[model samples]
Target: MTGISGGGVMTERKKKYGGLRSGQTIAICLAGLATLWISSGAVTQTPDKGAEESRAARGDQKILVRVRESVSQVRQSYVTVFGRTEAVKKVNIAAETEGQVIARNIMKGAWIKKGQAILQIAMNDRGAHLSDAEAKFEYQRLAYASATKLSKKQFQSRIRVAEVLSNFESAKSELAEIRLDIHRTTVRAPINGYIETFPVGVGDYLQTGEIVATVVNLNPIRVVAHVSEREVTKLRVGDKARILLAEGVKREGEIKYVARIGEQETRTFRVEVWFSNSKKVIPEGLTAELKLKTARKHAHKVSPAVLTLNDEGIIGVKAVNKDKSVIFYPVQIMEDTNEGVWLIGLPPRLTIITVGQEFVQVGQTVRTSRDEVELKGNSTDFNSVKSAS
Candidate 1:
């Protein structure tokens, strides 16, 4: 009876210990699930807060910048002006005597050589006057001959012979004057050039000193331009220049004259340049642009887009420092060309931002991306670039 009682107690204790062990296992599983849920919630909340802080920081940053450096080269600054071309020399053909135009050998627009006869004038009764003068001269010569022979032979008095000789000389003088008056009928050209116009045709009556035609010498052309007082000092006689026509043709020339006095109305000095027209393609009165090559110097050529104004409204360029901070540097513009502007400030070597230059401030620290910065150096040599920050 004592042994059976002891066995029953051991079985009861085993059952109680098993029930406590099962409860402990269930409690441990519930605690682990709660821990996992709390960790996941923290992971989601931390990222949202970090993203908000990053956006706020980006909004606070100010100013955008680009940098430019200087270079040495042949630079020129040209001013465009409207001008007209003219003939180097022009002449008007006029009638020298009053008469009817009998022959007009040269037509309008015809080219004539110097001293060429352009028209023939028929003088009314000129032929009759010339014949009468010739007859009287012959008569005078016969009378003078007879008187001289008789005086040598002592058949006439000395006084009578001298009086006849005087009469003969007077008749000859009158005849010569008549012949001269008849010869003033033909009109001539005074120069070698193309006839620009003709006011009278054949058979038309013309007066003395009447304009018959206009002639222009087209071998050498002249371009007339005006220069301001500021540019007058840069121009000198014999300076090389270029003449561009409206038709896209270009001709080379040299400055021939620079007026000493300024124009009364425009306040500009007149300048004349001469160019040879071998082909005669450039006509008179054509509009042209004159480009004068004045001087060349060392300068920095940069894109006009990179230029900016400072707080004081001074023209300058932005320069980047070693710390990626920007600073404004004032520059004197030497010239503005089709490619870029020639400037006179800054060092020869520099790193400038080409893209996104309008977004960053002067002193703000930016997380600069190496891909955004392009180093524009003046060199033709090849470079193997590595990533930069």
Candidate 2:
């Protein structure tokens, strides 16, 4: 019985020893798993740190771009407006006396001179009336002379002589009225111009103040334009202007008149520019464009491709500062030419980004390559630009 009891106690001791070994094995496996997890995290973090360092290095590098140095110069500005040609003088000739249009001398579209006869009226009883008036005037003159002689010799009373003088005056007035009526029978052109319309035929009877013909004086033709209120202030009488006609003809003119009042519907002012058309090449009612030169200003000329818009939709161009950092300059376009556009509101001396402007942003440091020949002729004349009409 004692040997069996000792064997049972030995078995119990072995079970406890086996249980402690199993617990130690589990702890060792858990320790190995924690070490592997920590090593994997370090491997992932090393790559991420390298990537962040690489991005920082790239950020410090400067973007390369091409630049051109531009200098501002005086440039003449102009205000362009569209309008039409008109005659300097237009007249509707009217008859001054009632008469029959017995003879037609001028035809429509014929150029006539001042005081040229346009129509002739019949003399209907006018000759007879003049002869009768002359005889009565002659008789009255003789009677008045005889009466004055008698009064001077004190052979006639003063009241009787005055009554005889009144009769003579009445006869003279009647004779003068008949002569004046005969002179107005012929209708004449008041000015030199082309006859635009002749409504009456040879037999047509015309009353006083009736239209005889329509005449238009085309020489020294005028260009009429309605200028905006904003632009009207820049114009004045006698200012020089350039005109472009619809048929590609160009002309020079002088501003003849400018209205002090504004048109109600369009809010514009009327302007008239006179151009010499001695050859009568410019006809009335031809569409034209007027370019009125204004004050000269300091401006820069650059290609339109360099123009860009900002976040707020402001038109500007990208340039480089003294520190080689990118900047934005707001610009106003003064004129557009075939070569480029003139820009105002920029610095007198400027460095513009000619290339790679889209890749860089404002306030970014950049590397620039100077284009020595980009800006040629700093003193370019404003007239060199082609007319953009």
Candidate 3:
């Protein structure tokens, strides 16, 4: 019995030892799996090297835009205003005395010289009156002589002789007045001009101060134009100007007068310009354009593309400063040419942006380059620019 019990005890100890060995083996396997997993993760992971290389390549391949600087001539022209053509001298021919129109030889559109008889009045009665006046004057002279002899010889009373002389003189004066009234029946033109209208015909009984015709002198024409009060200071008498007629005909003229007072309603001063119409091409009542030469100024010529608007809606060009900062300058357009526009209120030399101007904003720093090379040392060449029609 003791031997069997000892053998059982040995068997139990063997089973316990085998169970301990199996637990050790399981722990070792778990530790090995954990190490293998960590190593595999480290080998597969990367530091996004491809993305970094792509960013570096992009930075190095960035493009740099080039530009140039150039000088150009810019012309300054004043503002133009519309005006109407007027004659320097205009007159309405009218008769001074009332009479019958016995003859109407002159026709409309006839150029008549000064003192030319345009219409004749019937003077038959007038001539008769003059003849009667002469006869009365002779009779008065004979009567007065007789009165004087009678008074001198003491043959007649002094009062009676005086009364007779007075009666003869009165009759002669009445006849003379009748003759003078008859002589003022003819209608004549006062100046040399073309007849615009003829309102009388033969046998037409006209009253005194009645219009016979309308005449106009067109040798030196006058143009009446209104200028703004703001621009009045720039205008002066004798300033040179150009008048553009309705048919695009150009004529040289000078400022004749500038009104001191302004029109109440328009607040604009009236200006008169005189132009010679030797060809008579500019007719009355035709519209004309007046360009008064105000001043001459030096300005910069820039492309129209570079012009932009600011937040306040002011039109200007973008320029770059020495520190590469952007600056927007408001400019007045002095003139516009075919190639571009002439701008005022800029430095004589400027760094204007030709490209990327629209993308950039005022006060922003940007890389800049000269747009064009200077053709001359100091002088500007504007021959390439065409005149704006």
- List runs of model 1 lying over 4 Å from the truth: 1-51, 57-68, 74-80, 131-184, 308-316, 321-324, 329-339, 344-355, 360-389
Off by over 4 Å in 3: 1-77, 138-183, 295-298, 337-340, 364-369, 373-389
The CA lDDT at 352 in model 3 is: 79
Q: Kindly indicate the candidate among 1 and 2 with the higher lDDT.
A: 2
Decreasing TM-score order of the candidates: 2, 3, 1
Tens digits of lDDT, candidate 1, 106-225: 888888888787888887887887787788778878888898899899988899888888878887887877666565576667778898988888889988888988989888998999
After the best TM-score superposition of candidate 1, give how far the Cα of residue 31 lies from its true spot, in angstroms.
49
Greater-TM-score candidate between 1 and 3: 3
Comparing 1 with 3 on lDDT, the higher-scoring candidate is: 3
Ranked by lDDT, the better of candidates 2 and 3 is 2
The residue-by-residue lDDT of candidate 2 on 112-208, one tens digit each, is 9999999997889999999999999899899889989999999988998888889889889989998888878888898999999999988888899
The alpha-carbon lDDT assigned to residue 3 of candidate 1 equals 95
Predicted structure with the largest TM-score when compared to the true one: 2
